[model samples]
Target: MSDKIPEGNRSARERLAQQRERDKGREKRRRTLIVSSAVVGVLALAAVVGLIAANVGKDGDDTASGPAITPSGATGEASLTLPVGASDAPSTLTIWEDFRCPVCAQFENAFRDTITELVEAGQLKVDYHLATIIDGNLGGKGSLRAANAAACAQDVGKFAPYHDVLFRNQPPEPDDAFAKNSRLIELAGEVKGLDTPEFRSCVEEGTHDSWVQKSDTAFREGGFQGTPTALLNGESIFPKKGDEQISVENLKKWVLEANKGKKPGTATPSAAPAS
Candidate 1:
């Protein structure tokens, strides 16, 4: 017998080996495709969930029932709130901000004390317009939920204190911790009577969801540039004259200038919550 197989037999053996290799490669590619498709599906689901959560109160269709917010000194259908201050203050200070905005946090941290003093002294009427721009940007319900919760606090006359506490405990931008109703209720505990069953129910039911939507619409309609937008007597002072950065000193100066030649009324405590 010849050591080598006949030519025809040899050719058959080679073909068998080649076929095996091709089959192996095909199976490997098939597995890779399956895994890749699975990963893509998972990612797609996560993206969808994030979008839905972020858009919770964006459509202005909230029909949750709770105690209605009584508007004593509100504008825009109570979407804009008046902090505890003199009703007829000489200057009107309006701030458009998103709770999840780091820049808004910076603005709040820098001017919170001064702003409180002015409001307490009956020199300025602070009108706060909560916007949800960050939620739209970051794809989470935090901004929307937080704004709604703040409005809920306003319902019980604790808007000013509760507003400060929110900034004080604001989660890092993009974190959805503030979006949780439980977390919002926890923060409300800082304000007396603010964590009541009514408030909790209001927050959970998203009573102010429609109002938050209205506020966002107002912000867009105002034709303003961005969050932490500060206006003095309806004049833009945030980017003062040359876009100069604002500091505590300059902020006060601008306010005083707005009040110049105008007499300030006796400071009356506006709707402050009891401590």
Candidate 2:
């Protein structure tokens, strides 16, 4: 018998070897493709995460560029306060609030009449410190823009009425209505003599934006929990005072107690434009 294999058998062996080599090459190429795809996927995911982080940081930041243009008649620390009522009033009510906050609107609406009465009677003065907590939390510019508009109102001695109007016409928490200068100007129409060209210019230009941002930064750094932070004569009064829950009557009582034997304020604040 011959030792050599038959031609047909040899040809079959050669074909099997070629097929095995092709299979190995295919497997190697598939593995390389999978690894490349995985790397690309990871890189894309990382880019998305970085973008999200940047936007989140921007949304939460309260700092602003340019000079902090203190609004007219602003007082107290860093001139971040917008004063309402007599400067010499015996009792001072300090309020930190956000225009877009529903709770803040509720607070203002519930106590608006009482506050107005107290302010008119010279028994109490309010120092409003505006914040953009809603903008930071809910992702909108309404709080900041509305605050700037209110500061514009302050420039024209219309802050109190305009502030009331803004609260009265506040949109839902999710609605960024006040972000539009047109909406802010429209609301200003509710207040007498608040919609002048200068006022419009101020609102449109965001004249006091830097100031509002500074105020927001102060609120963040001030360690307060949230908006509508109310203090009476340097004491916390919102939601509670001592063992008493806050109510209109309780608020009045607290103010009366604090003003006991104290003279009401008589110094009238000038509404001159800030130089």
Candidate 3:
């Protein structure tokens, strides 16, 4: 969390209230959670138009092109970046998302691994685009807190794990008390190397505001009227009916296709096992 977070934001009681609200009568818990808030499970970086250049889609596989590896050299054990891949790869991919958006979560659950496999195999790099699609709504306050906490986690190399857990047990939309700092800490505890006083302090600070705003601006200025927007290797891919799950199969298809028919550098990741 940023040092700029307002002091009134954190409260153990508030956290408990959030938890209670999440546990009982979920259906009765306003259905505001499903409201579209752009995208989910990403930490979007600000990109300037026209000058952004990427050589992505250079899959490790000989037939499929993965991401471009910048001549500037590799990221070198940079594991703590966003759930999205690091920035050193050849191409830059950006996803504009909101945490409360179910479709965004679907996209993450379906494709995060394919993207990771490629990144680990030295193929693709993804940049998360965080949008405050939840601001001003029921879960708005909580999402704001969570978003800020996410930034704090990012600072301590806990982003990806924190992100994964947040969604794994993510509560319904418009009901983000579950997404508050306390729960965020609860989620962080599930990941090794993530439980720390310093880390906790950072999360409490709400540092991701600047980062979240950048993506929010992108969503609005970038022309996204809805949540869950994705730009693969810099090319936008519309979600299937906006209700479509970004399963591993589909993510690979788009990633592979973005390479312009180039073979995947690694064995094509096993298709999304039928679920």
Candidate 4:
């Protein structure tokens, strides 16, 4: 029976190959998609001799309510929202993170939405300071590539989506999964209305690496020397992350305490929860 089916079956297998090509073509047309690599280093861009906003809407952007943030952490209120689009939250919290660091991703996963709400409300501004601490001083090419990809995504107004993609697909070290710029472009294509070609070009040449560069300069000049370091209104905030991870409640209290005229350039003391 097997011998009898041989010629026809062999013919059917060859036809299947043709069908795959047709299917692939149809899928490409049905959905136009592209992604680009995002680098996460600053020094490399400068070493390579590379040099480098806009207003967001109310409703679709932010899901939470808050007040405007000022240079002052002196706001007497617990909550703050922006006057128009930026938050009036009274402080800026900068996070110096490495994409490869699982802890950094954890903190971001738990806080990005809340932080976005604050940024949209103009109550807070969170700047992601990319560093190679996770990848060593060289930080690997992947770090630089991913960081650059992030900058391009930020360009053409696709920062938030690209940001999520980075955290969602953070590479474990500079592995092959990360070396390919195709992966980044693939992720960028997932973002609606994102210009893949422009983004791809930006990432390929490491255009967005400038942000990473400037951030690194700031981190060093500002005297920060640790991973996952948090800075609030220029004051360092040290949160005790344990079995009970940092929550909005804890963040709220930290902000309140930081605002209460605490020591200059230091985190507000965290009090133990009452039983």
lDDT of 1 by residue, 200-268 (tens): 887898877766766777776677667777788777766453454455566787778778888774666
Local error of candidate 1 at residue 7 (angstroms): 99
lDDT against true structure, model 4? 0.50
Segments in model 3 whose C-alpha atoms lie over 4 Å from true places: 1-88, 240-247, 260-275
Per-candidate RMSD, Å: 18.3, 22.3, 21.3, 19.5
Provide TM-scores for the models: 0.70, 0.77, 0.58, 0.54
The digit string of per-residue lDDT tens for model 3 on 109-156 reads 766777777677545666555555555333245544565566566655
* Candidate 2 regions with alpha-carbon error over 4 angstroms: 1-64
| lDDT of every predicted structure (CA atoms) | 0.72, 0.82, 0.52, 0.50
Q: Model 2, range 1-275, lDDT digits (tens) per residue? A: 89999999999999999999999999999998787566445433433432332233235535456897888878888998889989999999999888887777777877889998899999999999998877776786898999999999998888888998999999998899998999999999999878899999988888899999888878877877566788999898766688875667778999999999999888888875632
The count of residue-pair clashes in candidate 3 stands at: 38
Q: Highest lDDT among the candidates is held by which one?
A: 2
Q: Which candidate is the best by TM-score?
A: 2
**Residue 50, model 3, lDDT:** 8
Per-residue lDDT value at 5 in model 3: 48
Distance (Å) between predicted and true CA of 231, model 4? 1.2
| Pairs of residues clashing in candidate 1 | none
Mark the 10 consecutive residues where model 2 has the least summed lDDT.
49-58
